[model samples]
Target: MPRPSEARPSGARPSAQVRRFTPAERWVHRATAALMGVCLVTAGCLYLPPLAELVGRRRLVVTVHEWAGLALPVPVLLGLASRAFRADLRVLNRFGPHDGVWLRSALRRRGPRPAGKFNAGQKLWAAWLTGAVLVMLGTGLLMWFTRLAPLLWRTGATFVHDWLALALGVVLAGHIGKALGDPEARRGMRTGFVGRWWADSAHPLWRPGD
Candidate 1:
């Protein structure tokens, strides 16, 4: 018979659960999402003729879009007060040796691709969104304050901004699709805790201590 110390009680809960995200992280995510939705909706009103007609206020729509774009970084900046957010930013900024392996494994749909707290895909998405936001903000400011730049430069900025917005929209759709498909990932962002089994299977390198 197994020793009392080694034996597990029937129906006992596992203690391997880990904190996936902090409260600050979830707040930042939700705030950013809300602002992004505002930007996208206002953008649609400004860009689409039918929507613009329905809204019947082009100037107001443009103002909302510009301000929403400007405010995109606010939540993230505020969330930086949390040490976990700063640490996650560092992790997202640097690609680890295992990242390439994880990507390859994901593409092949075989093997257990161990990752840290944030996987390669998540890191890539974060980097892309950050760069896209900066691009949009800069171009948007130029467009907003027309006299700040020459006519040619402003025109070029408009072109770049419009095309980049389309690309970002596509990327956002993919991001949302992946999130919707993964309930555990959504739960992690929602409640900040994730099951140990999920952590081990999806991110084996992640530890409670880490």
Candidate 2:
């Protein structure tokens, strides 16, 4: 009788799964998403007068928004405890020569642009989101603490915070739209594994041994 491996169809491997995001990465992503949603919803309540009146509990809403914004970095900080997460951070921070080519091709709706764990667009989003969060948090703290700064500074912070929040909301919608449109991309975050073929075509540079 033939061995089990030999009995299988030619070119069919016993293990076809490709590891994508690690458990730590997935957990951070989910936690951040949940907290971000809370922040956005509460911000909406505070920003819109009609919504604020309907909610009728300004103090409670403000408290929730403040805490949610503060907690946004908790998951990422905790995930950094994992070596894999740290390694992936290093990968995300550095952009290669291919990234520019990928961006151009993506904009033109051209052929597949080989990318590693994260393509250029994803890296850009990550960087922008990080900076935005930090800005929001700093300005939020300024607005909340009241006496920490002069009235003029506090007013400026509030103005910046309000406009940035609006921009963040739009960017977040686009992010969700992109994720929803790509089932394979969503699966990587949802299950921490991606089909080998999907990985090969979407992120060829991230393949095994690459």
Candidate 3:
């Protein structure tokens, strides 16, 4: 019988898997997603007359929405304790020369996609979502505790809070659609490991050891 190493074809590369999301990172992602889902569902119930009538618990919905939105930052805050999560956050925050090219290509719908661990679009989406959530929380607090601000401030908060919530729904839908379209990317998130081949092709700039 041939030795295991000798059995491979000449010049063939071994199939390897790379770590993608750490357990800490995945847990944070899932926890945040669950809370956001609760917030969105409860917001729909509170805002949509049809849903409000069907649900028939206006006060309960309001309570749930408020609590869920308030808890949105908890997972991200906890995630900062993990070294891997912190490293990924740094990667997401920094935009290199290639990122501009990636954004332009993305907008033009031509040329090669980004080869970074997180693409430009993903970075922008993450940043936008973070800001939107913080703004929503601030506005929500103003609306919840009327004494926090004057009537004019409270009114403006309500307007911003409501419209921003609508915008979040749309952006989140697009995010989900993109995720659903990428099986390998989804697999990485689901299993925490991805093929080296995928890493090379989709994220050539990403090094597993990095």
Q: Assess each prediction's global lDDT (C-alpha) against the native.
A: 0.84, 0.86, 0.87
**lDDT tens digits, residues 60-173, model 3?**
888989899999999999999999999999999999988898889879977877558987888999999999999999999999999999999999999999999999999999
- Please provide TM-scores, in order, for all candidate models, with all chains considered together: 0.90, 0.90, 0.92
State each candidate's clash count.
0, 0, 0
> In model 3, how large is the Cα lDDT of residue 159?
100
Query: For candidate 3, what is the total of clashing residue pairs?
Result: 0
Supply the TM-score for candidate 3. Answer: 0.92
The residue pairs that clash in candidate 3, if any, are none
lDDT of 1 by residue, 1-210 (tens): 632223334544466567989899899999999999899888888888899889987888878888889999999999999999898889889888899998898799776576888888888889989999998999988999999999999999999999999898888999998777777678788989876767766777877666
lDDT of 2 by residue, 47-158 (tens): 8999998997899998999999999999999998998889888988999988988998989987658698889999999999999999999999999899899999999999
The alpha-carbon lDDT assigned to residue 53 of candidate 3 equals 94
Of candidates 2 and 1, the better by lDDT: 2
Which candidate leads the pack in TM-score? 3
